[model samples]
Target: SWELLQKKVFQNKSCLSELYDVSLEVAKRCKGLPLVVILVAGIIKKKMEESWWHEVKDAIYSYLGESEEYSRGTVHLSYDNLPDYLKPCLLYMGMFPEDHNISASNLINLWIAEGFVQDVESGRLEEAAEGYLMDLISSNVIMVSKGGRYNGKVKYSQVHDIVLHFCLERSREEKFMLAVKGNYSNFRLSDWKESRVSFSFSDGLSEIASKTRKPFHQHLRSLRMTLIKGEVSNWSAFRQFSKLRLLKVLNLSSHRVGRLSSAALQALIHLKYLAVSARKFNFHPESHLPHIETLIVLCPFSRTVLPPIFWKMKTLRHVEINDVVFDLKNNKKWISEESSKLENLRILKQVAIKIGADDNVDVLLRRCPNLQELEIGILCDEDSVEICQLESLTQLQILRLSIDSFQLNVSKLRLPLHIKKLVLRGTRIESIVSSIGGLPSLEYLQLVLPTFIQLKEWCLGDVTFHKLKLLKLECLNISRWDASEESFPLLERLVIKKGHELEEIPLSFADIQTLKQIKLVQCKNKSLKASALKIKEEAEAIGGSDIIDLIVKDKGFEDAKKIITALKGKGISATEAAGFCWG
Candidate 1:
């Protein structure tokens, strides 16, 4: 059914219809596999075209055959394809139950530190994790999607119930997948005819504090996470060990360690990625774990914000948050500030930051040199200030700004080479765009419409962006469309939405030779709907000589009266497109 709908409807529908159809298709495919659906959606969005439908359909068909053995929604084929090394890794996830949303970065680092994804070609754990998850998702193994509308990328990932059942079943053989899942209460020792097992529960810590006691797990390789909320005297999850060799990633991020005890530090001799989020995490840096690679301190601020100076744990790659009283507030604070400065992070320009008047943005940016994509959360509430000189960022390719009031010395903030995907939202920054240095490479540009904007003022006069393509806008209250300089050599999609004050579209863009699509939407306004009719007439008058795609952005039924008025002189259907949505 989805294949048929995609073939017959999706391509020719309005933006809303397209989204609706795609979403339905994705939901149906999930079959309780929410993680798989979300992951597939992201992979599909990377390259959108008619081929997208074909590829998605093909992938689904392939997935159906793989996990045929698993009950209902569980994917058996994908499970069968898991490599020997990765099987233990996937089963390890059983520690977390259904609806459990874990941060992808934190989980990946734990996996890497456990000698899971050691074959790092680019020398980046996050990058390698993204690739690994992409493959898993494409194969219909998991899901990924945004949890909320935070104007940024998705953070938490929820797992399916069926996926958990499979993981628990597989863990019986190796005795892995033990840290979480209600502190291993779900796994009864009688159920496991295994003596050489690990203990990771609250009772162990309770015993350790009451009496210098320790529950040893000689065969335990790693403690993925310890998710208790309050204070515990010993290790938040893992208590003791005897012959554990690969005790790599220890994430006690959200637990309270009353004091950084020497005994706890001594147990993790082979630790690599240690994400310890406690109230008083004042343990010996060097003597405790000399080979630790990534040490994270999660606070509650979330990933959208990065804090000030972090502890210089020499072997650490990521850290975040500030736990002054020993309680971890913001999870993002655990990510080390030092990771951004590493020379290898030049390729990681997709930085998400909230820069305010109090923030020293200039100092913060100095750490990130090869920034390609910058998603800024700016709040210019008091004491309006100018942001850092963008010219220093020689490699910024994409810029998405959410500014309350962005005061930039535009003169000195030069556009980096090959800039693409520029998005400006919720701002009244009336400034001149004199020279956008890399105009050619820009493909997608989104501008949040204000009540009034000087259209001509932002023009790069008589300039043709040969490479400029898709441009989108939402709830932008502009007066008219300015195609007066619409010389986009290959413009494909132009989308404008939810404008209350839009009277007309720029007459200049009607005869765009290469234009393939134009989309418009009206929200809560009758006057704007009438203007849309008028604009359609004006646009048709110009469209008479071109094969451009005409989109009508309007609300309410433009019945007999509206049609008569629109076609009074310009005889064209304001409601229909001959082979498309011209009706």
Candidate 2:
């Protein structure tokens, strides 16, 4: 009660943050001053009532005693007497929306635009905004999620949930929204049956898809049906949809959809993102869906053939599938005009296969002049010249190769010179660095053993790559690291495998200046501590903490604590982290 009275008195007196609950404007009067917090909380509790708050504010007018100015309590008075006008300048923080993430740059620009900054001070607006935001934060009117400010502009600030709740209670008295729980029902709005509807069927099953025929007559622009238990709602089994303009985004994943029939898919000209799988059926080409940008058809080893008409989807940006077998053995087949028209394709993202048939995949790949990312499966069972030539994919950004263990000459796989991210699975690393030196823009590279294969000898000891930023090696049983890359100047994250046999940490990592994170799993190498220590020493010299996060999986809390203490004893801080397990 005393604190609340003081808050009222401060407001009436035009004081600084001496009140219990500090106002947003006055809290930043000091640099995270601790006194502001206790006083603000204390005063707020006493003035929790609405009438009291009004009286507190109204007293400002009465307390001035005929003068135009009055005390703003302790918070404002301290603010008014600041070395610079920024005390009040910082308190007027209404430019940013409540709960909005205010960027340091953004705050500086706003302050500059408002002409509230003195030009002589270096980082003038940013420094002032920083002091202001910090004051508000320390006083509990705001919070700082990100510890540091970006671009040296403004201090990060967030409102508390309780404060937001108070505002919400007052502001949302007339506006409120409540979400109804449970799966979408077959019982839909009868008035808009012809219109497209977004439906969720993750819980077991719902008869909505099956019955879209009976009561549905609207043109569906999109239909996303995912997380269902079984096959796609056998709507085709009942009746063919009128015109697929009736659908756009059709996602029937984790379900058993035999096929997207040719006739049923004819009129879907406006389709964009389609995620469906025919585990035991084939894709029948019907019409071209020009609007489709993302297509995913994950299928196991089966007879589900891709429709030849898929060549007409010129705007395709993403393709994610487990496996694909292109059979071009028909000697009497003919190529249509659409087969040569692949110029608009920008992405053919991911592909997996057990066997690749003898088809002109070269001619097929040549059509997408803007291809950016590709994941090819080396499933050349009977075919030798599988991936012929992809020199045309100049815009290729990411390439992943998931190959079977038996396939040899893994080095034959090639990529565009400016690729960004490359991942290799079930492949040997003979001249990994040299062979990959052609990639000028490569930022990330991941090499993992798919099926318990030991990494015998990867002469990565003699090559140099100037642009590799991230290197991830997992699940490969190796005893040593003979890597000799010219200090990956921008490498950031290094993740070692869990439950793998590794004798020591890579000594090559000792010189990388930009290295930021290193995660160790089940395998703790003999040099792990030394490597961590070196990183700590380097980070501190560079004015930052290298050991930001440490996760010790499959270790007891006590043992984890011991390991952490040992590291901290070595001057490298460590913490035990927990992962969320969803049932």
Candidate 3:
């Protein structure tokens, strides 16, 4: 509690030495309850006055008098103290299921769709929503469940049971949203007057459709049906949603459902956010959703062909479709049109662009010039279609390129200067690793090459990855790696997967002060494992303790036990000796 208070409130400010006693007293008043301590700290962090601290201490003391309801009182006080703008955001958390780890991106998008996040000085709603999330996180109202593997940014977040309960109660009081869990039979349609409604039950849509013969809620703006189990076989049930003319947000992407008919969505002219899963998707956004800002189509069964009108949606900010093909051949005239530019588009993922002789991806990329994250697969076998125009996308930060059966000649590839994360699959980069290393803003680089075409030798002779933090090499045949600490001065994590032919990691990596974790997966080389162990030993010898983590994984469970036993014979603890496997 004291540490958290110091970090969040004091921020290691030595000038606040006089408040140490008062802060300790305040922390002690919470009785070691983490949430209460965090709430108290968040309340007092705004003011540095000694009198204010004392007042906060007394206020917490008053809550402590109610021993049975102390936690609830403290939480309620915190909620009451929240700023008006943030109250709705907090209450919105109840819309998700209990114990559900919500995606930060999805939550922010929802907040944006719900008009909870107001415009900030930067004019980006996403940034403002992120600030709100961080504020809640700092206050301990929200918990960071998981972070991104490469960037370490919060990917998943969840609220505690107490907080969730509080949010649900407050939401009910405010009539903000209705969350339907378990059977839909208990749900009363007349009682649901809230603008937003979320269903966490099976066959929720069918039940509601069958119950309501007419348009039930014309005032409803958002509706989400999260199927926990079983697929919705009745595709016709979706036609019932057409009555919701004012619906702004609709999500039914949890389970496999039938193709959403255009007629069902034709009446949803006010829809801004749409997420649906289907075997085949033929919904035309240009004709149907004129105001759609976020569109997500999940088709895991087969590749869905996106219509040419997909590129013409001007209001789209985020587009994510899995296993989808874009037939840009017929869309050439549409691309050449001056008004086809998607200036608001920020994210485009898992989109396979079919490049032919007459059309190139450059023409398409020129339309969406402001894309921040792009994951595209070049579906072409000809060598003429090369990714040479990515440098024009100066705003791009994350890029994943997959060129199937095509060698990505790095010499010809001109990457964006500001890209922070780059993942290349089915591409050859053995000859020109220096070109990629020269990226000034790159922090994470993952190379997952095909088995038949392996990177033989990667020698970092004179090049330096100045800002690189994580380097992942998978399915590579490189046997010799000539690198020093100078090569990757800021690298923290090293991951090698299926590197069967690689001899060992360079001993010089042990000397890199910033190195923290070295993970080897299915790499049968005993010498490579020994090299990682030696790095740990050397790091401990120099740094005075075990500062580095070594995780090794093979294919066999028994071999992992044997390796753990062997490591235990050494000074390694059981926790540190885990995660080893053998092929």
Candidate 4:
């Protein structure tokens, strides 16, 4: 708590020392509550005057006067002081049930769709919104539940019940968002006619629909129905949404969409975001959802196919599906015409399209030059020259290729110049070092090739992988890995999994200044653990830091740790020989 406030308020050490008594007095006013201390600290972080400090001390005392309700007033004051743009974002967080850990990615996406996020000079709208979330966490408004493994970004965040109560009261007054948590039958929509967003955390959509009268439907811009019990409910009442002229976002569970009408959905021309199960909604060629910018379809079926009309959405910004197939063989001309209209697309994921001999993927990629992230699966008997066409996506940053049913020559794989992360799964690659060496911006790579057999030795040449940070080799048949410090100058994390034939680790890995952690999972090589210990010793000798961690697990790590600790206690410095076995 003090660390967060120190960055915002007490950067001047000398000044903070001069006001030591005042700071200690303020700390005493907190009553050992970290939340109250942090919130109060944030509130007065900008005021540098001595009188202002005394004023805050007096207020904190008065605020905690006689009642517990008054004690919560401090948290409420913090919420009230948040910026106008952040106010709605913070309050919307309360729409989720208490104690729910919200996904940062999904929340940011919803905020963008609701027009709550705005682009700043530093980054995209989502990036700016992430900054807002971090700011909230720093101010002790919300707590981070989990952090991303690779980027250290917040993956999940949670709010306290006290803070959530404040949000609910504030949001109810502003008519920003209404959250219904109890029985749907008793819930009333008469008082929420001016509300712009609505969320239901229970079942019985029919009762809510029965009470949703005419003009009340016109004021809603967003509707989200979440069924905690995962029960199947009738959605025939959703026909009322056809008259929701202002509706922009519609997210519902697949079970609730059983009776969703096709005609009513097509009438939502103003919709910008739509997420529904593919098996529930019937897709036709003439069914045009023109204004949709972000389309997410959850497929519960085996067939991976999308309606032909989806290809022609001109204003599409992001498209995601569980699985999808495209017929570019017979519909080349029309597909090209439709794809050319998607100039604004930034993200396309889970597109498992089958390619023909004459089909070229360049048709889709070349049209969307602004695409930043793409994941597509190519199902073929042999590698197509079309795979090399990805070089046209000059702005592409993240690429995932799932080549099914055949081998693709690793040397022939060509990626865009700016690509930063790459994943190759189910592709037979003989060697990867030579093909990926020249990538200047590549930072993360994962190769999963269970059927691979051609690769025997991976020779990473000098001064390759200049900016690579994370490398994961899983389910490969490689027997040898030859690398030097020059191979991965900036590599920090390395993971080797299911390498049954692998026998050793590169000792020169210790020479890399940035290497921090190495994990060997399910690899039974005897010399691998010895090499890891050697790497740790060498790294400590050169850098005076034994911070490198080697995690090796085949059955259990704790049991291994216990055995190793016992051996060390007995002054027996053991080394690996043959295979590991414990009686």
Candidate 5:
């Protein structure tokens, strides 16, 4: 418990040397409860003075009197001690269901919409919101559930059951928000005056909408229907949503509500964030949502055409569409104007652009000069499509390209110099290594799912990925990997999935001091597994025994069991061997 408390309190354990006795005493007062230790550690880490430590120690001792109420009391103390700015931000997390892995981006967007994030002089509101999330994580109030595949940043986060319960109770007391679950027959909007309402189950949506009259919803700032238990065919409730004139955030992305008419959306003038799943979206941004900032459409099965007016909305910051096709041809006249630029746009994702006689991807990209992240799908039947002008997007940091079925022209591909993360899928280009290796700022690269056939050989000859950290290769048939430690000097994690034909990882990877993890999934070669073990041993010999980890996953249970047996034979404990090998 003391060790865990120290780890939670200080990143470098040496900082606790001076306060070792006091800190140990504080840890012991928690009665060996991990949650209590963590919560107390979070509270006391901000101040290192001996007086503050004693004060915290006394407070914990006073609160943790009963064993049954110890965890709850600690949680309450943690909440009471949180900084004023973080109070609302932490309370907002109760909007999500228990055990729900909340997307960090979605949570940050909601916080920004709710005015919980303060403006930072040096950065955007999104960055400030991210800082707020990090503060919560550091305080141990929020737990990171999953890390991003590329950068290993906190992508999904959740709170423990006790913390969540405390948040729900405190939110109710403060009338900050109300989360409704199961039936809504007894739910009365007039009785509850919270500004935010989250419905865990969607069955009560229509009932609540029909029963709740005007003036009750006028004060509502946020409404979210997170989970759908059944198909909701009666979307007439959305017509009633027009009464929510003061609503700032409305998230109905869980259910596919067939055409949400423009009349219903035009009433939400104050809406800053909107996420919905619909068969078709026909609203005009200029006439309707004039103050909208973040728009997310979650219709993967249907192809939605983005309105040309979106390019002219300066208030718009982030736009994400799943399986969306940009109708640039029909809206050419709208985009042709030189003044129509998305100056404030920061993110555009999964937007399919057709390169033909009418639509030029370059023309559309040039309009969003400040775009930082872009995920585009190229639909071209020709031999190659020219996206060579991406370097014009000086602010572009993350880029993902998905090609339909043609081979990408590697020679003509010009990536942004400042790009940090890049993902290419369904683009069958054999000479991609040379084109991407010399990137000065590239950090994360993922190449997955070639269109027709996997590229047979990948030779990383002399070029270097200077800042590359994580490399992921999926559905590739590369039989030989030729490279040296010089190729990826800063490479930290290597992931290979479905690389059945791959012979072995380059032995020189063992020489890379920064390499920490090598994960192989569905690779059937025994030699590959043996090579991975050898690499682990070599990394241990050079660095320390705890430096590198080798993870193997196979579909066949027998194969995984055999690998586990081999790992145990190498002096690894049964539990550790089982963790290293998964079926």
Candidate 6:
């Protein structure tokens, strides 16, 4: 994991002899382990000041004196050595709960909000922020636990326990942020006089402090509250924090905040990143927050009505919601000639959309021409969502089209050529698959079938999906999956889940050398299981077993177990009886 940093550390030389000596001393203490060496180098690389280098050298000398003992001070040294630019970014991560798998995009957005990332000569501010994240990853400061299938980028990242501990310690030492856990009586505002950021893991914000009570820090820039407990009564406390003119990042996701006063948000003009999870949020008609750039509303099992105040928020760069109905038609006054379009919007994901054509979703998409990723849902039956309108979004790369209509026509839907990943779910149309194979740049595809739908057969013609890498077909009744070797030539992972009628695996799959993993979940087809066994046996016979992994869940299917036993009898590896119960 740290090998990349090791190579750079060993090959890069310092101009000054004294600097080299200090670097060598640190390297020698690392004992050739990549993790330690990389951590040491990450700090050393930023030590351009002679005084700072000397301080670091002295610290390393002290740490080496007690090298025989197992102490976390070694990793803490790396945190102490971080460049000014990256210190806050790493420390901000420690604000999240321990063992949390943070989203790379969210992390970058937060960095941008806190002014940690600046525009470089090579790219925009966000792009530069991404580069900084990559630097940390290369330095072994963060690990990529999940990779994006379509774009081949890091989706989820996590900090190691030792690194996280170091972040907490250094953050306290620097008065970067104050963390308050459990009850509010134990938290004192006077304790955080030097800190501008606060992380509260309190049981309930309502139980913390009264709004009328004087705040400890008037210049607080960031406040993140996680694992909030109980109902919130008076929002007066929140209105008090509105006076924090420097506050930019506020996350209330862990709490069940049902209502918020518009007065609470009107004063937060400097807020750039905000995340809140609630059943519903009310906004004042006169409320205006011009600096808010990233807004995330997570109403997982409920709906959050986005008030009309959002239409005027033109500075938004990214917006994510579990359920929302953006009714622009009702708020025609918000769309004046002077109103700026959402050209800065790069990512928009709406899990459940109540208002469709009436809301003018297409017109909104046209305004957001630079949108790189989009996820929307169509829930109305009479709504005519012109998916072709998406063709105008030339910069769009990822799309998820979800429709729950029983009488909607998608026959004329033409997908954009630039889309790299697409997810289609709950569509009753039978010809959806035929229209999807023509996507030129599509690399990842997910098709989720609706129950009681008429769709049955799926046919992949030759030369289709030329660049496809991952294909997931779920809850389908496609008994016949016809394909050729020319189809999905570049496919790497194929996942078929809950497909009860899928009769057999495609023979052409064995011909694709790029194929690596085939996962079948709750698929009862015996022939399909046997075909998987045969494919493994054939690959092993030709010394290609290393290139393939066949994973299956029988789901209590008797014949599937017999097939597994037969494969084992043939001297092929099988772990079939260990079924996964979906119930």
lDDT of 2: 0.50
Report the alpha-carbon TM-score of model 4 versus the true structure. 0.86
Q: Each candidate's TM vs. the true structure?
A: 0.55, 0.59, 0.90, 0.86, 0.90, 0.83
**lDDT, model 6, position 553:** 73
> Residue 18's C-alpha lDDT in candidate 3?
70
Clashes of each: 41, 37, 3, 0, 0, 2
- How would you encode candidate 2's per-residue C-alpha lDDT over 1-583 as one tens digit per residue? 3433345334455433433343432333322334333334333334445455444344332333211122223233333333454432333332223455645433443344334556545423344655655555544444555642111223455544334433333222322211112455644545342233333444322344445554443544444344433533543321334534545555555455655554455566666666666645455555566676566676664644455666666666566665654444431142334354555554464454443454565555565566666777656655553444556788777787776754455456566887878788776665345677667787777777733223543445445666776677777656655563254666766767652556545555655666666666665543443344445454555555443333334455445446555666765533211111100
Candidate 5 lDDT, 339-423, residue by residue in tens:
8887778889888887766677787888888899999888875745554457789999999988775555545777788889999
Model 4 residue 10 lDDT score: 65
> What TM-score, to 2 decimals, does candidate 2 have?
0.59
Give the distance in Å from residue 423's predicted Cα in candidate 6 to where it truly belongs. Answer: 0.7
Give the per-residue lDDT digits (tens) of candidate 6, residues 263-380.
Answer: 5777778889888766666556678679889988766666655555776788888999786666566554554333646767888898455445456555656767788889988767
Candidate 1 lDDT, 1-583, residue by residue in tens: 3433333233455434445555566547645444454434434544455466446645565456334332332344346555566565566566564567767666676666666676666556666775665555444455564432212334556556666677766676655554333454465433433322334444443332243322234334455444444635355433443234446655555565544432466666777766665545444423445566665554333232222222223354443434222111232343335453533233222233434554455655556565555665554435555544565676677776665553433334455556776776765423424344246677777777432346422333555556667767677655544445355656666676776556544545544555556666654444444444444445556666434444554543444445554565475444332212222
Candidate 4, residues 61-175: lDDT per residue as tens digits?
8676544465478787777667878878888886677888888977777777777887565236666878888878766788899985556789899988878888887778877
What lDDT score is found at residue 391 in candidate 5? 76
Candidate 3 lDDT over residue span 77-188, tens digit each: 7787788898898988888888899999999888888888875753377788888998888766788999977677889999978888888877777888888888888888
Best by lDDT: 5
**For residue 510, what is the lDDT in candidate 5?**
92
Q: What are the runs in model 2 whose C-alpha is more than 4 Å off?
A: 1-196, 202-215, 226-240, 243-245, 258-263, 267-269, 285-291, 300-303, 330-339, 352-359, 382-387, 405-407, 410-413, 450-459, 524-550, 561-583
In candidate 1, how many Å is residue 344 off?
Answer: 4.7
User: lDDT score of model 4?
Assistant: 0.71
Local distance difference test values of all predictions, in order: 0.50, 0.50, 0.79, 0.71, 0.80, 0.69
